[model samples]
Target: MIKPSSPTPDHLRELKFSCLDQFIGPFHYTNLIFFYQADAAAADDDENGYKSQALKQSLSEILTVFYPLAGQVVLEGNSSINCNDNGVAFVEAKVLDGRQLSDMIEEPNLEELKHFLPTQHFVVEDNIVLLLQVSFFDCGGIAVGFSFLHKVGDGKSMGEFMTAWANANKYKCNKCKCRCDDQFMNNFNLASLFPPVEFLRTTSLPSTTNLSEKFVTKRLILDRKKLTDLKEAIVSAPGSQLKDPTRVEAASAFIWKHYIIDSAAQKRRQIKLQPNVDQVEVVVENAFMAQHTVDARTRMNPPETNVFGNCFLIAATEIVNYNDQQQEMHHLAYLLRKAIKKIDGDYIKQVQIEGERYFTNLFQRLDPVLKGKLGLCSFSSWCRLPFYEVDYGWGKPLWVCTTPIPLKNLVVFISTPSGDGIEAWINMLEDDMKIIRIE
Candidate 1:
C-alpha cells in the first residue's frame, strides 16, 4: 500500500466521533470499483504512472479536510478516531494474465472481481479506515477500487469525499483561495441528536458470515422502460391501490419475490429427499423481510444529508408471505412504501427520544436471521447518489460497479450512468443463484 506523500498536520489530530457513528454496529468496509477504457496514446506515454502520482498527491490534500479518514478508529473513553495523520492505504495492481476490462464486465464474476479489491476479505483491521487500489488491464483499461469503513460514513458521505478528492486533483485546490474545510463540517455535533446507548457498549451485535464458496453475486439491470412496465403492472393488478411504485421499490419487490420462490423450491427439494417424512406434516417454512436503507439526511427537520457520519438507518417491513407471484410483488411494494414512509421527521424524533431501547429492539429483531430461521433481504439504494460524478481529470468513469458482498441476501442498487436504469448487484447462495438464473 502506498502511503501519503506528507504527514498529517499536528493541529488536526484527535478527531471526534458522534453517536451516529457508533450505530454502524461493526467495522465493515463498503467496496466499489470504477472502470475506464485504456487510453491508447497514454499507453505509450506513461499515463498510468502519472495518474497514480496524481491520485496519491490529491488524496493527501483531501485527507487534511477529511482528517478522520486519515487516522484510525480507537476505543479510548468512547469510540472515536485518533486522527494521528497516519495516512490511508493505497495500492496499484494489474489484471492478471492479460485479462481485459471488458472480459470481466461482459460476464461479471464475484471471484474475479474480488481480486481487484485490495483487501482479502471485508474485515477492517490495523486501524485502517480506507483501502484503495488502481488496477490496469492489458487493453489499457483502468479499474479504480475503493473500500472504506461504513462507520466513517454512508454512501452519500463516500460520494461527497470522492467528488472533493477528484476536484482537488483536477483543479489543484492549493492555487485556490477558498477554504474547502468548511464544506466538510456536517459530521460535527451528531452526538446531541442520537446519544450513544450504554447497551451498545456492553453487548456486541451479531454478524453473519456465509461461506464464500457457497455464495454467488450477479448484476441485474432494469431500465426505465422495464421499471415503468413493472410499476404499471403493480398499479393495474387486482386489489391495487398503489399509483406508482418507485424504481427501487419495484426492483426490490421483484428481486425479493424471486428469492422467496427459489428458497421455497429448495425446501421442497429437501423434503422430497426424505422418504420417511410425512408429506402433510412436512411444513415448508418461508418467512422473508426487507431491510430498506434510509438516509437520515432529509428525514431531519433541517436536513442533514451533508452530515459526515453514518446518517442512515434500516427500515424493515413486516414479514411478506411468499404467495402467488403478482400478489406478492404488489404486497411487498406496498409494505416497503409504508415502512419507508414512517421514517420521516417524526421517526427521527422518536429514535432520539427512545434512544437505547430503540436500538436494542432493532438488534433483537435480527435474532431469527442469526439463527438461520428467517431470510432478510437487505437493500441499499445508491441510485440518486453522485458516484459517477468523480471526474479526477480523466473524465467520468465509463462504468461504476461493486464487488460481491460478504453477506447473503444483500442487494445494492446503483444508477446507470445514463440515469435511465438501475443496476441491482445481488448476493445469494450458489444454489439460489442457479435457480434465479434458470427462472
Candidate 2:
C-alpha cells in the first residue's frame, strides 16, 4: 500500500459527498492507465527510485487538497467521506519476462492490463477511494494505472485532481496550496440546490455484470480525415436536422448506426428457431438505446466547469427502426443532440425542485433495462478531458488509455495526443465485437 509520505493534517479531514454523488451510489470505479517511455536522463539505478519518490511525495502533498480521495467512502448517514488521509494503494509491478511495451500494448489485452491496476480486481472497500499502480517494463517504458471510486468523483473531478498533482510535481511544490480545492468546495452549495430523496435510498443502481456473455475490449482510432468525413456525412445525410454537428456527435452517430445494424442481424439469427414472431418486426420494435453521460459543469447556470465530484447525468436517446434502409446517421446525431439539449440549466433546476420525484421516475424507466430486459449502448467521451496533460515531473505520458470495462455495449472515447482525432475504447460481447470490427 502507498501511504502518505507525511500524515494528513487534522484540520483538513472529513469531506462530504453531495446529493449528486448519491445518484450514482457506490459500486463502480473508473480506471485509467498511462504509459511513458523511460527517461534517458535518469539511468542511475535499475529500480528508478528517484521517479518513484517524486510521484509519492507529490501525491502525498496533493492529498491535502484532494483529501477525500485518500479517505474511505461511508454509506451510512447519507453517504459521505471520512477524509482521514488513510492513503492510496500504490503498487509497483514488472512487465512480463520477455515482453516489450510495444508487444504488450500493440493490441491491448484488457485482462492483462488489469494486472497493472491497484487492488485485487476492481474491488471497492468502504475506506478506499483511490488506488494506483506503476509498472516498469524491460524496455525502460512505464505504465501508470489508477482508479477512483465513482462515488466521490467523476471524470472531470479525477482529471482536475491529476492535473493538480502534476502541477505540484512539475513545480517541485511539495507543500503547494491548490486552487482546485476552492473549486471543489463551490460544488457543495449545489447540495442544497439538489437535495437527496427517499427514492434514492430504495433504488439500486443496476449491475450489468453478466458472466454468461463473453466480453472483449478493442481500440478504434478515428483520425482527422475519418472524423471530418463522418461529420460531413452526418450533416449532409438524408433526414439530417443538424447544420454543423460536433465531432463527438458524428462519431456517436456512426458507432450507434453500426451497433444497431449488428444488433438487428443478431436478432435475426436468434429467432431462426421461432418462426411465429417476425424477427424484422421485433428488431424494429426493440431498437437499442444510446445513453451518454454528459458533464453538466458548463451546462449549469452561471457555467462552472472547475467544480469537483459527479456533476453529471446520463442523457439517453432512443433508436427506433434499426433496420431502416435509409441513411440514419444524421437522424441518430439529431436525436443525441436533442437529448443532450434537454440537460440544460432548467432541467437541472427542475431536478432540484423535484428531487425525489425526478429520481423516482428515472429509476422506474431505468430499472427495467438494468435487469437485462433491453439492449443499451452507453458512451462517455473523454475527448475534451485533459488526461494527457499530466506531466508528473517525468514528462508527459506517451499513451493514455482505459482497461476493459466489465459491462458490454459501452464505449469510452479519449482524445489522441494530436487533439485532432479520437480513440474509442469499445467493449462488447466477443461475437458482437467480431461483427463490429468487420463493420
Candidate 3:
C-alpha cells in the first residue's frame, strides 16, 4: 500500500494554481483512445445484470481516486467554451456490434461528431463529451474505446490519471496492490491561476458560417522497409544536408508537401468568387519539428526522472502566401523543409519572446484580399509519445486510434503501432481529405 501524505495547507495554494494552469489551454485539443478485451466468464455470470457493470464500477472507482486532481483541469488563454462555470461533462455509451465500431472508426466523420457534442451556442450550458464504445467479439472478449477532449489535458496527463484510476480499481477487487502515492496529488492546488471568468475570446475566431462539410479518416501504413528506402533517398540527395533526419521528420515533410501541392492545384482549378480576386491564398501550418524539453528544475539528472504530464510548449512551422500560379510538388516540399528548419530551438525561443509582436504586426498590416478566405491549415506527427506505457495491467493495446475531433481547420497525427511501423489518423473536412496525398 502506498502511504498517504499530510494534507496540503492553505498557505501553499500557488502550487495548485500552477498545476491547473499548466493543463488548461487557450488553443489546444486532445483525445484518448482505449482498447479493452472483456472477460467472457464475467459476462456469462452476470447475465441478469448489465455486463458492463464491472467496467462502470471500475471507472467510478478511478474517477473517485482522481477527484482531487479534477480541479487541475481548466481552460487557459481565450476559449469560447466555459469549463469552469460548467463542470466536466462526460458521455458514456457502448458499441453494440464490432461492425458499428469499425464503420465509425474507419473514416472519422469529424463534422457530424462535432455537431453531436455540446457546443457553447447550442445550449445555455457547456459540457465536454466522453464517448465510450464497447464491442463484444464472438470469442467473448470485449473492447472499450475512449474519445476524450484535449482541452482538459494532454495524452500524457490523461494516461497517468487513467493508470492511477485502474490501479485503484484493481486494489478494490484485491486483484493487485495499490502503489499510488498521495504525494502525487497533495503537492498541487487546483483553483488559483485562472479564476472563473464570464467570457473568454479565442486568438483566432471561428468562421461565421456553419461548417456544412463532411469529414473522413484514412490510414496509410508505411512499413519498415519502405520507410527505410524513403529515408535513404532523402539523405542521399546531394543538397540534403540534414545528415540524419528521422523517418518521422522525413515522412512528415513528404506528406506535408503533397497536401500543399494538391491544395494549390485545387485552387487553380476553382472559379473565382469575383473578377478582382485573381490570386488564391493557401496557408499550411503544422507542429512538425517542434520539441519541448523539460525544465532543469523538473529533471532528476542523476537518479530519477519525472515523466508525468505534458511538459512541452507547442510551436508550428507555418507557411502563408498568395499564389497566382500553380507550384510543383517538389518545390512546395522544399519550401516546407526550409520553413521547418528555420524554427530551431534558438528561433523558437526568439519567437516565444516576440511571437505576439510578429502576429500583431501582421494583423495590423493585413492584406485586403487574404482577409477571410484561408483554406485548411493543420499540424501532424505526434512522435515520441508515451501512450503505450499506459498499461492498466492488461498489457499494451493491440491498436489505439483517435479521430472525429475538430481543430481550427484540421489536425493529423502519426504514432508508432504496437506491431509495426506508423499509423496515420487525420481529422479533416471531406473535401480536404480528397486532396490529401500520402505519397
Candidate 4:
C-alpha cells in the first residue's frame, strides 16, 4: 500500500512520464462536484474567517492527497494535461450572489469557459480542465461544481479521490506529505496481448454536423418496488430464465429498447426529400457497455497486480440497424442480454486485442462513417457502484449533475441515488427527446 509523505515544490515535475498516457481512453475521465451550505453571515477574506479557514484547510488536504499521487495522477493523464500542456488551473473559491448563481444555472457561461480553455487533442495536445465553482444560494447553500475531463478517469475513481481529499481536509492534516510508489511508475508491455494487424479493419465513422438546441436534465427515480417488478417481468418473459439476470443487464435492456423506440419515432417526424421515402432511418447506438468488475488477475496473481490506477475496460455494444426491421421491446432486450453474456473470459481477451489493433493503425485505416456515428448514444449503469460512501466530512452530496459537452449525440448516466432504487440522467437533442413516449 502507498503511504503519504512531505510535500515538495518539484513534486509534479518528478511524476511526469510518458508510459502512463497509453492506458487512458478518450472517455475514461471523471469529475466530482461537492455542494456545501455556508453560514450566511460568514465574511469573505483571505486571513481569518470560518469559510476562509475551511477553504484553506481543504486546499491543504487536496494538495496532500493529490501530491503523492501527482505523478500517478498526471502520468495517469486526466487533470495533468490541464496543468502541464494547457494553462488550466484549479478554480478558487469566492462569494457569489445567490440570485446570480441561480441565473447562471439557467444560462451557463459555456462559451466563455470554452474560450478560457479550449479543448485540445489528446495525442498531440493535452487539454483537460478541473474547475471548482462555489456559488451561494438564496437558501444559504453553496453550489460546488467540479468539472473534469472525461478522458482521465471514470466515475468510480473520481468518487474515490473526492472522498479522500475531503477526509484529509476535514481532519486538518498539518504535516501532510507526498510519497511516490515505484509500482505506479513501472512500465508494463501491453502490446503483445492486444490484437494483431491481420484481423483489423477501418471505416469512416459518423460525424455530428448539427447539435440540439435548448438542453435540459431530467432525473427518473426507480424505487425498490418498481425495480423488483421490472426484474420479475423480465425473468418471467420468455428466454429470460438465465438463473440470475443481473439488474444491470435488465435495466440496460429496458433503457436500450426505450432509446430505439424514441429514435425511430423522431426520424418519422423529420422531412425526407427522397421520393417514396416511406421509412425513416434512425439508429440507436451506445458509447460502450462498461462492465466494471475487479480484475480477476489482481485477485489470482499477486505480483502482476498494478492497482495504482484504474483497471477496467469498456466493451462497446449497439443495435446497428434499428430502422431495418420492426422488433418487439422484449426481443431487443433479449438480444442485448445475450450480447452482454458473450463478454465473458475469452471475449475480454479479444476486446483487448481488437482495441490495440485499432489504435496501432488508427490513422491509416480510419473509416469516415463509423467515426461520425460513434457516441450517438451512451449508456452507463453504475448500479452496484459505491459512490455514496464518498463522504469527506459533511457527508455525501445531496445531488450531482453534469454539464453538456458538445458533440456527444446522447448521454446516459445511471447511478443509485441516495435512498432510492436507481437514477437515470439522460441528455439528448431537445427535438429528439420530444418524441420519446415513456409508459
Top-scoring candidate (lDDT): 1
lDDT of 3 by residue, 1-439 (tens): 1111233234431222222233333333354455544444544434413545444555554443344332223244432222121123333343343433334445545343332232323211223323344444433444444544444444555556666655654455342456555524442222221222222223432232233556466656677776677667667765655556566655555565556567666665563444454342323221112121222112222211233333333333344443432223233334445555554555534433554443444333323213445343445455455565545455555456554544333444546554346665555566777886664
Output the better candidate (2/4) by TM-score.
2
Each prediction's RMSD to truth: 2.9, 2.9, 7.2, 7.3
Cα lDDT tens digits for candidate 2, 9-59: 675465555567778753677899888766444533545666677778877
Stretches > 4 Å off in candidate 3: 1-30, 38-61, 68-138, 170-178, 182-210, 271-311, 318-376, 414-416
Global lDDT of model 2: 0.74
Cand. 3 TM to true fold: 0.64
Report the C-alpha lDDT of model 1 over 1-439, residue by residue, as the tens digit. Answer: 4444456667656655555677664578898888876665665327778888888888887777777787888754446677777778888886668687778777777677878787876777686988888887767788888888887777888888888887888887663632456777546556667777665654444666645457778888898989998898778878876778899999988887777778777777877788887754444256777889899888998786667777777799887555674336787788889889989998888787787776778878888788776778889999989888887777888888888876777899999878889999898777667776422
Residues 190-302, model 4: lDDT tens digits: 22333223322222222332333455444455666766776777767665544455555555556656666666554545524444654322232322221222332232222
Q: Which portions of model 1 show Cα errors greater than 4 Å?
A: 1-12, 75-78, 174-179, 211-213, 272-284, 325-327, 437-439
After TM-score superposition, the amount by which residue 376's alpha carbon in candidate 1 deviates from its true location, in angstroms, is 1.6
lDDT of 3: 0.43
Going through the candidates in order, what is the number of backbone clashes in each?
A: 1, 1, 5, 27
- Would you list the C-alpha lDDT of every candidate in the order shown? 0.77, 0.74, 0.43, 0.42
Deviation from native of the Cα of residue 235 in model 1, angstroms: 1.1
